[model samples]
Target: MGKMKRILYFRHDKIGDFVLAWPALAMLKRALPEASIEVFVTPVVASLAEACPYVDHIILDTGDDKAIRAQIAERNYDGIVMARSQVRTMFLVRGLGVPYVVAPKLHWYQYCYKHRVNIQMGEGEPVWRKGCRLTERLLRDNDIPIPSLPTQYWDLSAERPKWQAFYQKQADSQLVFVHAGTGGSSGSLPTSHFVSLIRQIHEQTEQPCQFVLTYSGEERKLAEEIHQALADTPVNVALAPPLDKLVDFAKSLVAADMFIAGSTGPLHLAGLHDVPTVGFYAARRSAVHVKWQTLSQAHKRLSFTPPPGRRDGRNMALVDVDLAASKVAAFLNQDQGK
Candidate 1:
């Protein structure tokens, strides 16, 4: 540590994982204001990182070892940090030959880092909080002063009006955004559960709510299933507009009055927007409420498992639809009063 001039951080993962790393990245930039900080992210989340104020540059992880090495070698970063650890990323750090690298000490790859943050998985902290703590420890070990970091960070000011336009169409009606399709990270409720939830919301809210079913390319059928099933309901299940970019997808969330989903990328995105949300989750230790829950106070998580001890990950449908509907309705009402 002779006052590092440049740093590169890697978090080549999904949108949600990249979002969770925001606090740590912000802290790093705050602590070292003069240092050039760039992020190496997957193509899926590159645009989202581009919107972050903390990141000075965005390096897309092309997954080509030679290309990555060449790109990194050119940067000549003084330090590298892995917000989400991966063996390939470790090798990338090694190949670049960055003088100082920091990462969690949870894996065998700890030997490669000049600084290691000893952390246990599921240590009673949200993943984002864990990321912040890890970055803090890394900086502390290197005698770098820590700076304040926000609990959440997303620059939606430019897009806020754009999203507000979408919501304004509903006027005083509550706009509830629902994502029934799971991103394969955690268990998902059955399509029927979603259909039932929508039906219940319409009844409970007395038709004062509009519903939008957000889905990915692979989840079109699931979305359609709910749409078709609710064909006769007074509430219309509109499909969200085609979202081809992560930044656009995130911007679209600003229009939401409330969001409903399982533990997924969009759910996490809504949390960043401070949207009231309700999520469903499976009842496994790793996927438990505390670990995978949304990081928003105006949110609710309904965790369910068939036998409480079952870990097969097939119990998302077991989440009581009526219970979820009631909670979601309550959350929306709380926002209504404000």
Candidate 2:
């Protein structure tokens, strides 16, 4: 392999999918320090892509196939790693004469890739590791040594102070961000469940907490209702002020002592900072708690799932939020005790 200099890494997926690939992307950069890495991302996550420290460039895909092909051709990439490959993406780079192209064996386009790693076909492996496997193949084939990925990669130092100053006002309270909306892999908890969980946590907390209810789109009403339901409660609760950009919201997540949400993108963002996370997952194979688990450490994250049985994964109502809240409150108390 003659010193590959330019690489285009594809993670043109959803927000959470893109974030999970961060470590693998970082691994590629470490393995080839001189190569300029470019990531292909959806417009929804373009801002967050700019904040990635590992990659030198970002190519925002606007779903225009012609424009995408033009952009890919313009770069004259030395290699392309289809970390989150789609049928469209496979076709786009098909005959571009790129020196090296690698992807998981997904579509019949497996014939297109000179190197294909069998990933995403398995159930137990985490998504990040799947991406890393692709990077490993790229390294071994190119005679480069595979390197370890950092547990935490992005530098939030600059973004941290903004929340630090705001949090200073409530010096005695822990910052808990509870996102009411989710990018659906499964059904989310109902408003009543969230309210019950919040009330339970409030009742059992070892220390005071400032609950910041966060929501996107139509879930605003759900967040508001949770706030209204807790009006008479003694614990402090507030609505999270609207953030203009996804990057800004991501920055805010780093400051959280604890983050709570359904299996979603924001939880993965909190995972980036290693904030303690409490998440709800479905029991189905596709949305299993382990599959979508946060990037937070095992000890620092808590997960709940609906009971396992026929159709149980879609049964959000069967999830025992009260019990979950009790255990999670205990987890928080344990942390405070330490």
Candidate 3:
């Protein structure tokens, strides 16, 4: 309660989850300016947390009980906070015997299970931000300093030139980025849908709307397919670079007139950067996964209401490509008017 000299924050999730946890971290740092904050994150998102200024150290592990126990045993942490509410994470921290531990109570899980919807619309039911709110409440109840909501935190000044370079290579015309990929996950829009959408956007916006096909790793295949499909069209399609150069990629997204993507990490990034985004919602997951916070009021969400029982898959055809292009064009025109 007095001061947390040493603390541990645990988040075993994807890149988007880590990014969402930024708000909580910022609150903690503000409350305990001198506290040495360490994070236990999944290896995939470890680098992102390490990049956070509020985090002093990052413990990269997959939230395994033995690994967590071993890591805690080696460190003399004064407080422990788990952003994730998995049973394994709970037991691991409880076993650590830390003097001050923060986690949601057992009852909060029941509440979450009852009200939560599967945002991914994949295998099981969705989890909502309500769980995160519960976790933050628990931390506050335990006398830990909570952080503010996660917003955009970037050194854009350093990234401007990189973005300009990418933009310069683009055709001398209006450019729109269509992000149809998720972060190495199954809950993404179909490639066919993306290709169809891009083709439609090109026809509607005959101004040679360059298509920035942002993707990574194995997902690059999807981008390539989109390029091949639009080979004859005036639209120019290109894949986003590797993860190490994400700052530049993010900068490019911010500079774009409009972004058309599915509910994913980049959507949140776009929202944070004040980029007008048109998100294609897959279903129940899409409803929950889409960015709830937007720096710009002009952002739009084009959700597809999947048929009942078919809610788990990308079955909805509620948003047509023509509508999406119209929205993007309107958003860009509004920006120009400003």
**Please, what are the lDDT tens digits per residue for candidate 2 over residues 1-338?**
68989999999878899998888888888988989989999899999888887888999888899988989999999899998777789988988889999899887878778899987636665667888888888888989898877767666857766875654427676778888776666468887898888888988998887788887778789899999999998868888888788888888887787999984788899898888898887787664677777777778878888897777767788899989999988888888623
RMSD of 1: 2.6
Off by over 4 Å in 1: 95-97, 298-307, 311-313
lDDT of 3 by residue, 1-338 (tens): 45557778777777666766665566666767887878888787655676677789888785366876888878888776655667666556655557666555454442332222222223332333533464465456657656654345443545544664666545455556777676432246667778877776666553556667777666678788888887886666776545465544555665565676764577656654555666665545334433343333333433332343555445545445556556555555555422
Q: Which candidate is the best by TM-score?
A: 2
All models, RMSD in angstroms: 2.6, 1.9, 5.5
By lDDT, the best candidate is 2
Candidate 2, superposed: residue stretches over 4 Å from native = 121-123, 167-169
Clashing pairs in 1: none
Estimate, for each residue in 59-143, the C-alpha lDDT of model 1 and write its tens digit: 8888798788878899888887777787777777675667777788767888877678766655566667767777787688779
Candidate rank order under TM-score: 2, 1, 3
